[model samples]
Target chain A: MSMRRAEKQLARVTGLILLALVLGGCVNATVDEMTYNEPVAGIGESSVVILGRRHKPDYDTEFDFIECIGDHIHSGDPSIEVINEIAFINQFYPWFEPRTAPLQPQTIDQLLQLPPVAARFDEIKLEYMIWIDGNTENTESTGSMSCGIGPGVAGCFGFGTWGTESEYEATIWDFTDKVEVGRVSAQTSGQNYMPAVVVPIPIIAPVQGTACDSLGDQLLEYLSAHH
Target chain B: MLCFTLLAAGCSTKQVVVEGNFPKPLLDPLPITLGVIYPSAFAEHEFFDEAKGRAESDWLVKTGEAQVEFWDILFDGMFDEVVHIRDWETVQRRAAEIDGVLIPAIGDLQYTIPTHTNVKIYEIWMRYEFRLVDIAAIHQQEDGALSFNPDEHLAAWPITAYGKTPTAFLQTDEEAVNLAAVVALRDAGAHFVTSFGATPDIAVWLDGIARREQDAALSSSDDASGPQPIAQSSETSSSVEREPDSGGTL
Candidate 1:
């Protein structure tokens, strides 16, 4: 009986080890794998389509800025041509609702029908698409001390605390080949805001504006100079 | 037992992520000037006769008024940055003083009958082009073309709407084009400077110059990379001649 009990204990330990290994594999699989190809250089007339799933507050503001910049380009240069302006009417992603939505398949098909959309873009056109997901949820902790004792006495006891901050992830895909080219995941804490302010702050505000502005400026300049 | 094992295994997985950063180029502030290039023709359609008194009458009375108003608003917004040149001659004179030239060309302008209005109305469509000429290279580097069709309609009820007087329409078109020009110039100029500084070949050249200068500072060195030689040669070889401008007002 003693030997049997020892064997049973060993089996339980082995089973636990195997379970842990499998779970570890599962966790590792969740990490995203991003890759990019070499940059191509050439000069030719190209057309671009800016499509989005839905109009959110942030997106609307972004589009307004984009349109303003685009107007500048159009008014200034004759070689650069704008083909079409289209938008999708669907809310595909619920988790990041209002912030991001999935582009309707029909919209994509319709855009493909336009001659300018695919006329020059045989294999090399750059299709820019953005997907924003997740929300900021966080928790924190502190330490406390109390007096306790054995039997009839009390002794001092210290408490420890821990917490987590909410995080969100954004993925940008190049639809020319229907593959994700870049992904950025960021986390914001309550401490990021002003100490006295009660309002929650968005961590992406600075990044979004800065990245868009920089990229837009660069691309426009390149097109202007080259075209 | 299984749950405990799974949790333990999950904690052991380690992933190493790698990231790369682009090289940063040193930026030096240098004084730069830009010129303007104007297109010769102003008419959108070939059918319109320039000599005919009534050729532009209908357009000027209806869409032109709206355009003038648009230009006024645009100019008011950019009063601080842009220097308003009255005509092409002034633009050319100013262009000679600048390092580069931004020539805005009006590609198309039209007014279509409004479809939604209960009464007669018009929708103005304006398209313009911007071209940046690198004076030093004597080459056109960048061009951007865009159009705007403001959906707002002017009510036909007012007698001033059809007024043939220049006051009713001249400023509106000018304002819209000028506003568009200012934005285009600012964006294009910023882009050009950034790109020129960031180019790899240019960066290497600039770095070599910097390194040579640094060496000269530390040691008694003669002209190594020919520091002031290139600048002097270019300046002395070129004559500052103003080009003739013939484009009309926006």
Candidate 2:
């Protein structure tokens, strides 16, 4: 082949290789799919209501898991009345003591607008309320090294470490005769981090499902058997 | 040229390990009950306010509906769960159970009829307070506060600026209030949850950490790698272009 032709061929090959490399680097990350087990039986027929809220927008995954558990129970036992609505948790409800601030009529109106399911149920009655704590630890380490220019012929650099912990509480209430009959409380903790990195790539960890399922199951079973 | 090409290829191929660990909620089937209660005057307020005085009550109904929808979307989006109701009495009974029991309160209303214009801007401020009650410990825990300023949220709108019809302004304000409430709830929830415990479910814990790191990174520096970047990416990417560019060299 002529010298000019060979050079052109080499350039074409190099360009193709570069294009492929860049395309290969593209990645799309997503949360792993979760699996759930069937609800345990022997609890019998009962009615239930749950009010829960997550402080963070992304924490909906937790509620989804809880709902899945509720669905399982409803599927297994037809007589069990399960009314789970995040709205009832009253995200607007004040948490401070002395409770001086007047409840917003608008907020009350919003709650009232929800389906009147509570008024119809007679025998079994239950309510669950959840709150996510914010005092968690978080850490991250990132560094980069470039062999050419700027600093030196050969150079290296890196840093990253973060930790945070937050609290969450679930309050269960039983409504019988328009009164609270029972209340159960539970709490859990969580922590996570991203190790050191040289590039600006996204780092996501594999998350294993925790005890939320058991908590949901236990709450349902308790309501079913009791009420 | 060959050496440079080889080096570039190597750099691109080098895999930098990135790992993260956090908490996730467990999935367990359970039966639960839910209830929704509203003041008896809700319907009357809507009909009377709309039919008689300035028709502001229609706006109230719209605002109420929007608020409910907003909460439904917000919770559904965050928890991946749906609130199902078997009956409405459960909600009334629940509300009645706490009838005398004072809890963290929220709600206030103020209306101003402009002297010059025929428009009236009703400012609705919805606040939420959670009295962290530790049932297990049988003691009242810490309390958190969150407030929503709907006026500030809607101040920049064209309708509000130009003094549009009360109906139009009311619609705008209603939308604004709904959005503001969602934000307030999120903040209040975070504040309440954090005050009670330092740890959260594994998935939530990790997510919280990621958010904190992101916030720290953002506050410390304006670099794109900070926490704000993740938020922007997640929020803005919904409208991002997916098609690849195709063109000849200029």
Candidate 3:
């Protein structure tokens, strides 16, 4: 009876500890948007292409983050269509490559003057082109945990934490009108904790996911408003 | 024996072979039949980097197959007709029929990982040297037979390309290295297609070809058709100038 009572107490304590770990990590996020021009009317059938800017030497906008935003926009509104980034890039190979891609809205106009490019552009009927830039990075880390093994017993004991920050900007251009439509940006930061008694339990902060959510919400609203 | 095998496994060198597919470029093929010579050394390129520390492993990267594939796709898209030359003898025999011969070789290659650069990415850099042989000059020898000069080339230029992939997403170092190499190859192809005619020597050679073709047409035309103008397509007539800015922007 004494042994049974001890086992029950251990089970109750483990449940409470797991509950605390589940709710430990926290993140803070903010989103900002600006409109330079309204979306063109009667262009709902065309698709939008979201591309990540990779020209920066030190960092690149993660491809998964771009896909997350694209997915959010499509899921939020079933009518809106999103083209695969790789397909669109490959179809226009060298023209849209890092070295040759146009920098300004006017340069896009020059590209469309080519018959082959113009034909492909018309076939796709691209409504809007969104360029995403930025990255997520670990900002700070502190504390450490150590593990040891001896005589058939191994365990870790300590507390540790780390912080991550994500910043990103999305620029939207109206391909039909050949003009800038608007911009949306999101910034987020979070702290993650790992506390160990016997086994280390990690509570990972959703830093990138939060940023993607904020940016995607704003973009969806902006694109769907006119429709 | 098992202990010895484990020790050997721990010290085994890492090997990576690059492979990728490239799409055909969206542009009008230039109006010229070109001959391309791929040297044997270029077709089987391999780079070996020894580990500088005990913590790192040696690497042997082979990019020969990928190089050949990339060049084949790029040449097919850039020229009207591509004739592969097996050797200089083939070039000598066919020099009169071809507009020019282009020879490409790997100049140098280097790579870095996160462990070495303290950056969270894997990067590869490649230098390519291109030689454009003036077939017209070679075919116009005073003797009936063609003369060859190893030191003579109408244009020789170097192009540099770079590629990098973040280490965060890749699961293994070999995968990261392979990706970086493929990306570098694509960059080189894009640069060449965009800047081929913009090089100074190439521009002069193109002008000479246009003049020669125009003169030949004028001579062959009947008196009634008198001094026929060279028919140049809009795409062919436009001059592609090299961008002054380096690295990508916007």
**What ranges in model 3 sit over 4 Å off?**
A1-25, A40-42, A147-158, A197-199, B1-10, B87-93, B135-150, B223-250
Residue-wise C-alpha lDDT for candidate 2, range A112-146, written one tens digit per residue? 33233223232233332222121112233333323
**Between candidates 1 and 2, which one is better according to lDDT?**
1
Task: Give the winner by TM-score: 1 or 3.
Answer: 3
lDDT of 1 by residue, B70-178 (tens): 3333333322233333353444345434433334444554333222232222233345444433333222212322111111111101001111101112444334323
The C-alpha stretches of model 2 lying farther than 4 A from their native spots are A1-45, A53-81, A86-159, A164-166, A177-187, A196-211, A224-227, B1-178, B181-250
Q: What is candidate 1's lDDT per residue for A1-227, written digit by digit as tens? A: 99998678557544544443343222101223233441244224554333322232111222333444345445555555533332221111111112222343224444445343344335434344444343222245443434543576644433322332333344545555565555544443322111111121111113233333333443344445443
Task: Judging by DockQ against the true structure, name the best candidate.
Answer: 3
Worst 10 residues of 2 chain A by lDDT: A96-105
Cα RMSD (angstroms) for every candidate in the order listed:
27.9, 28.1, 8.3
The per-prediction tally of clashing pairs is: 40, 81, 0
Worst 10 residues of 1 chain A by lDDT: A88-97
Cα error, residue A215 of model 3, in Å, equals 0.9
lDDT by residue for model 3 (B1-250), tens: 7668766755679899998888898888888888886766678888999888666788999998889889989899888999887644565566555777787888999999998989999999999998887543233233333333444577888988898988874368899999899889889988998788899999988888888787776677645466554333222223111112221110
lDDT score for residue A41 of model 2: 49
Per-residue lDDT for A85-183 in model 3, tens only? 888889998887777877666689888877889999989888889999899998778766789877889998666778889999999988878778888
